[model samples]
Target: MWFERPPGVPDWSEAESYLRRADPALGAVIDRVGPCTLAPRRDYFVVLCKAIFTQQISTAVATTLFGRFRDLFPNRRPTPARVIEVLGRADPAVLRGCGLSRQKTSYLADLAQHLADGRIPTRRLAGMDDEAVIEALVGVRGIGRWTAEMFLIFTLNRPDVFPVGDLGVVDGLRDVFNLPARPTPAEALALGERWRPYRSIATWYLWRRGSVPVAAPAVPVPDAVAGAPPCARRRRPRPAAAPGAAISPARPRAQK
Candidate 1:
């Protein structure tokens, strides 16, 4: 249950009522989970970079790496300038020492460049529609459809943006619909239609019911790299708690 909701988060009361009326299956999920506690955050620059850091790595590696990355900037703040400066170095050891791969470092460079050059209108994202926000974000290196969707749900707190591609959502469908196996993306999208306009919240409950797949990169990747392919993930997808804390790859504010 939410002890406190930050400013402007839509009331879950209305969503809960509608979902309960619309689908009893999801209502069961909501009842068991208690309440939606998705606390969206600001600091778009930092969040975007966090998403990049999580690419193609496990949560433990991502967490430690992002912490070291914070050390690169003054006062442990990762401004665009700081990222640009550190990544600009000729030697690879600069970021590699933090366990970042060349691909991830390059992705971070692209993101920092976009922000520093005013490519992404971060301040205006709240006003943009879901598609518009996805468009703006995907233009940056490493930010893809899936990454944008997570950003929508977790960062902007959008009400409807269902991520059919997410393995966790599909796995949850297996439990909710009692399917023999995880639904295909197309199958998942079609099934998700029942929850329309509140799929994001419905998905939160689904995540509570199923496994949140380990961190996959923004770019296309094999299931092995992401830890589990869709068909096999249900066998042992990490608990939802892992993704809740590590999906973004951002460190705590108090990290010194």
Candidate 2:
């Protein structure tokens, strides 16, 4: 059962109709998965920070690290100014202590700097088209095309993004379409042509195919290193992937 509109998200019935009409292979997935249920998040920097932190880490680990990270902020939430201030006081080692890698630490610092300097104005994103938004976001350190695509889908709720580089998406397509081998990014893009204008809906279904459900990050992470937000709670352990399942690696390539 699909809603005409799901709270903050745009109506998805059009996208649903298009995807089913465009490809029977995807139609099967829709039949199994039902409807798109993406909800937008308001905190641009937090979500981007989470995306960077999540690079190459399991969701469980990422959840833990994010909890530790939000502790550094005054309210368990990070704004550009506060992030910059915290980074200044806490050296690289301190950040790494929160489960961040050297590269990710540098990436966060760079992002904070960009946001503070207004080089990557989060407010301007609403007026820009998808490719322009990607261009803007990718200019930041450690943020790639795949990351940009994710922002478009999860943050802005753009409908047509197809993250061809995502392993989950690739594996989903491979299994769903019965391809002889995992399709290359180019092949994935070609295969996705039919789902145009609503590819994001299709992507939502693909991700669901082999994913473990976790509570949304909207619940702030708990156990602050410095008396951060009290709203954070530890996420429960998730079951491991089944044998021969498609493994989602950290940071999909930003190409094709």
Candidate 3:
């Protein structure tokens, strides 16, 4: 059997150098997070199937459901024939209970049909560019830019993909840049240009930074005010105020 790495994959140092010059904020994050490597998969079908299983669900939950799906077909990785045999007459409710949304169920079924009909041409995807891969995969019901980008990253191991549509990337940018609001997809795409040719590595750092807890900002207490009377300390409010009472009003009443 022949084996090959996917196209557009850059060496780690090359990707890291590009990211380091792209943005200081992201460069710091990359330093902290270190290198990330894509998980290996034997073929496009397994990755696409996992992508279908993962939509709109937590990673843990997706793993559980995928485990069950895999258990249902122990002889081999899920093929269209095997999937149809297990899911064709199965209740939609049962599938939903397995954690698949209604739309995802439809998407999976459609994907299986396409695979069976030879419409997807999975082998051809490896040789295609990012845009071509997206165009091919998006024809399926549930696959969008994010999903296609995931396939490109994990399955094809493409080094330059940036999933600007991902909420994680948006949150990462907000945290790293201290932005007042999360960046929109267009904004992220525009901002990501500097990382070009290695956006995927930059994205991995962003994802890692987003997952780590940020330290709270240190607050400073003011030094004693000049000309303040020693008795001024006695004027402080007591902590025994009623639960509904205002703790600090905008204006204090004049002393009687």
Candidate 4:
């Protein structure tokens, strides 16, 4: 009778037991991965803005850019109003100096306006369901289904979201399930349904599966998976198929 609970919900032991009963395949992953204790971000605006900067880039580059973007505010949290003001006064090149492309700058500007004007209702998102948040956020120029879904998982802490477009998630599912090939977006969604009501928690474990330990020395990445979004498929090689050892090499893609 155990089932996976949302972020604010307690009784993880019961939820884990429920998930084990619901899908033994995922249960195996749970056993291997151990518990999920992901901390959700409270700042929706900053997260979405950072998602734009992270698209199609390496993590080091994203880190650098994110730091620079934050420095524009200099010890502040970079609210939407301040972002819009800075964007208005600063040169496009100035914003680009933070590693944003011209397109992303435009997207960021649009996103700031939406939040500033109450179009996105960023403050009210906590009360909305996943789909409602997605619909509301996607109306902004740069935000898409994938970005909205990430916001749900990382920002809102919604437990049921399944970001099938994410290369890491797709590859993680393939390796965990021992599929013949990587699943298409549709197929990934279908497979993720089995982890219902706590797919976000499941996703954290999947990412962990493919993730190299923080202290592990860097290893050469293998060739990218075909059809994966640019810069999102470079993965550390998995050791020859052993149970609990199959890791996806795919990186997180910042889908626009």
Of 1 and 3, the candidate ahead on lDDT is 1
- Tens digits of per-residue lDDT for model 2, 1-256: 3324456666677887777677665665566555577777778899999988887777789889889999987779888888878877887777887888777777898998988888888888877899999998888889988888889988889888998888888766655554445666766776677678888888887776553322222211122311322112223334434533433433653322
For this target, which candidate reaches the highest TM-score against the unseen true structure?
2
Candidates in order, TM-scores: namely: 0.78, 0.78, 0.71, 0.76
Instruction: Output the better candidate (2/3) by lDDT.
Output: 2
Of the candidates numbered 3 and 4, which has the greater lDDT value? 4
- Give the alpha carbon lDDT tens digit for every residue of 1-256 in model 3: 1124245434476677677676766666556555554543556766777777776565678788887667667664788777767677777777776677766677778888877787777767778899988877888787776777777876777889988767777666556544446666666675567678888777776766643433221211112311233311222221222322211111111111
Scored by lDDT, model 2 comes in at 0.71
- What pairs collide in candidate 1? none
Clashing pairs in model 3?
none
The sequence of per-residue lDDT tens digits that candidate 1 reaches over residues 68-125 is: 8898888888988888988887368867878778887888889888888877887788
Sorted by lDDT, highest first, which candidate order results? 2, 1, 4, 3
Ranking by TM-score: 2, 1, 4, 3
**How far in Å is the alpha carbon of 59 misplaced in model 3?**
1.7
lDDT of 4 by residue, 1-256 (tens): 2235456643356556666676665666567566665567777888888877777786579888888889889585788889888888987777778987778878888989999889889678999888889999889887788878878877777878888877888867665555546777766776666677788877877776632221111221222333444332433434534334534324344444
Q: lDDT of each structure? A: 0.71, 0.71, 0.62, 0.69
RMSD of each: 9.3, 13.8, 15.7, 8.6
Q: After superposition, how far is residue 84 of candidate 3 from its true place, in Å?
A: 2.4
Report the CA-based lDDT of candidate 4 relative to the real structure.
Answer: 0.69
